[model samples]
Target: MTMPGRTRTKVCGLTNADDVAAAVDAGADALGFIVDVPVDTPREISPERAATLVGAVPPFVSTVLVTMAPIESIPALHERVGTDAVQVHGDVDVGAIDRLAGDCDAALVKTVDAAKPESARAYADAADALLVDSTDESGAGGTGRTHDWTATHDLAASLDVPVILAGGLTPANVAEAVGAVDPYAVDVASGVESEGGVKDHDAVRAFVSNAAGASADGAEVSA
Candidate 1:
C-alpha cells in the first residue's frame, strides 16, 4: 500500500467500529481512544469498549489510549484496554511518565499543554512522542483550538523524538499548520467530525490527503 511521505496522522476521539474502520481505511497511521478521564468529552469510552475497538483494528494502525488515570492504574488499564500506546495527560508529572514507562509495555505519549510550553522541554526525552495541545480552563485536551505554532516550531526543532501537533486542526488549515510547525505527525478530533464524536468521512479523506501532500513537500525541500 502506498503511504504518505513521512508525516503521520492520528484520528482521535473515535467511538464506534464504523469510525475506526473509516479512519484506518482513510489512511490514519494511528487511532486514539479516550479512557479513564475525569472531564466529560463526548468521545470518552470505557476500557472494555476501548478493548473491543482495539481488537477490531487491523495490523499497522496503532491504538492509543488517551487516559488521565493515576500512575498506579496504568498497567491494569493497558491490560484491560489492550492499547498499543497510552497518552498521559491531566496533571501529569515527570515521575508519572517514568512510572508509566517502567510499568507498561505499550508506547508512552506525553501531552504538553500550550499553557505550559516549558513543560514540553522537560518531557521531551521521557516519552516515545509528545502531543502538543491547547489548554482550556479544565486542563483537559481535545480543545479544538490552536496554539502558537511558532512555539511548537521551536519545540519540535529541539526535541529528540517526534512531535504530534493537535488542537483546532481541520482540512482547511492543517497544511498551514504543517508549514508552520513542521510536526512529525498531526492529530485531529473535532476538525474532521461531522458532529460530536462522529467523524465526517469526506473530511477525513481531505485531511489525510492534505497532510500527506504537505509532508511530501517538506521532504522534497529538505532533500
Candidate 2:
C-alpha cells in the first residue's frame, strides 16, 4: 500500500522491453500493459509479449496487465501474462470482479468510468484499488481526455481503497490533477507516449517529478 500524502505513478501502454525500462528509470511505480483489447487500439499486446516484458520488471515496480476480456477467460490470461496485477476496464460488473478475485492471484485494479461516482464504493470493496478514467466511445479508457476532478476528489475522499486517477493526464497537468483530486496514484498512457505504445522518456521523468512535487507542496489546483 502507498503511504499517505505520497502519490504513486503508473505509466501504461508499455509494449517493449525498452519502454518498460524507460518507465522504470523515469521513476514509474507501476507499469501497465494493454492485453486483449479492441482490435483498433494500438496499445494492445499479446500475452506472450506481455509475459516477457513483465519478467523484466524489477521488484517494487509493479507489472499490471490491463484487460477487457471476459471473467471466464481471466485465469488463462493471468497465467499467460504473468503480471503482478490486472486492471479490468470497459463495462464490467462487480460480480465479474468478485469472480476474478477468486480465480486470480494477482491484485485487481478496477477502472470505473469517470461519470459513475455512485458505483465507486461498491467497486472499491471488490478490488484492491479503483482507477477513475475518461472512457472513450467504446466505453474503454485511453481516450486522452480529462474528466471532472471535483467528482473524482469527492469519490477518492469517500473510499477507503486507493483511487488512481487516469485519463488524459500529462506532465503539464499532472500537478494540477494531483492537487485537485489528491489521488493515491495517477496513471498515464497517451500522456507519456510519443505514439500509441512508444513512450517518451523525458515526458515520463517530468510527469513523475511533477506528481511528487505537487503532492509535497499540497497546493490546491483550480477546477
Candidate 3:
C-alpha cells in the first residue's frame, strides 16, 4: 500500500522489452502487460511473450497482467505470466473476483468505471486495490480521457482498498490529477505512449517525476 501521503505510479500497456525497461527506469511502481484482452488493442501480447518480459522485471518493480474482466481464464494467464498483479477492466462480478484472488498468487486490481461509482466499494472486499478509469464506448478502460476527479476523490475516501486513478493521465496534467484525487497511485497507458504499444521514454520519465512530486498531502512519494 502507498504510505500516508505518497502516490505510486503504474505504466500500462507494455508490449516489448524496451517499453518495460523504459517504465522501470522511469521509476514506475508497477508495469502492466496487456495479455489476451477480449477486445482489439495494438498493445495485446501473447502470454508467452508476457512471461518473458515479466521474468525480466527487476525486484520490487511489480509486473501486472492486464486483461478484460472474466474470472474463468485469469488464473491460467496469471500463472503463465508470473506477474505480481492482475488488473481487470470491465463489469466485474464480486464473487468471481474473490475467487480469482484466492486462486492466484498475484494480487487483484479491479477497475471501476467512474460512470458507475456504486460498484467500487464492493470490489474492496475482494480486490487488493481498486482502479478508477474513464471507460470507452464499449464500457472498457483505456479511453485516454479524463473523468471527474472530484467524484474519484470521493470514491477513494469511501473505499477500504487503495485506489489507483487512471484514464487520460499525461505528464502535463498528472500533478493536477494527483492534487484533485489524492489517489494511492496513478496509472497511464496512452498518456505515456508515443503510439499504441510503444513507450515514449521522455514522456514516461516526465510522468514519473511529476507524479512523484505531486502528492496533495505535501509529502514525498513512498519508497
- Candidate 3 versus truth, CA RMSD in Å, comes to 2.1
Candidate 1 similarity to native, TM-score: 0.93
Taking every candidate in turn, the Cα RMSD to the unseen true structure, in Å, is: 3.4, 3.1, 2.1
Q: Better model by lDDT, 1 or 3?
A: 3
Candidate 2 clashing pairs? Answer: none
Model 2, span 1-223: residue lDDT tens: 2338668899999888988988888888999999997647788889999999999899999989999887789878999988889999877778888988999999999998888787777787899999999987666899899999888988888888989999889999999998888899999999988887788899999998888778524673232
User: lDDT of all the models against the reference?
Assistant: 0.86, 0.87, 0.87
lDDT of 1 at 214: 78
Report the Cα lDDT for residue 44, model 2. Answer: 89
What order do you get sorting by TM-score, best first?
Answer: 3, 2, 1
TM-score for candidate 2, please give it.
0.94
Against the correct fold, how does model 3 do in TM-score?
A: 0.94
Tens digit per residue, CA lDDT, model 1, 97-163:
8877989999998888976778888887688888899967656788889989888887788778788
**TM-score per candidate, in order?**
0.93, 0.94, 0.94
Please give the range of 10 consecutive residues that has the lowest summed lDDT in model 3: 214-223
Using lDDT, rank the candidates from best to worst: 3, 2, 1
After superposition, the stretches of candidate 1 with alpha carbons farther than 4 Å from their true spots are: 1-5, 216-223
Candidate with better TM-score, 1 vs 2: 2
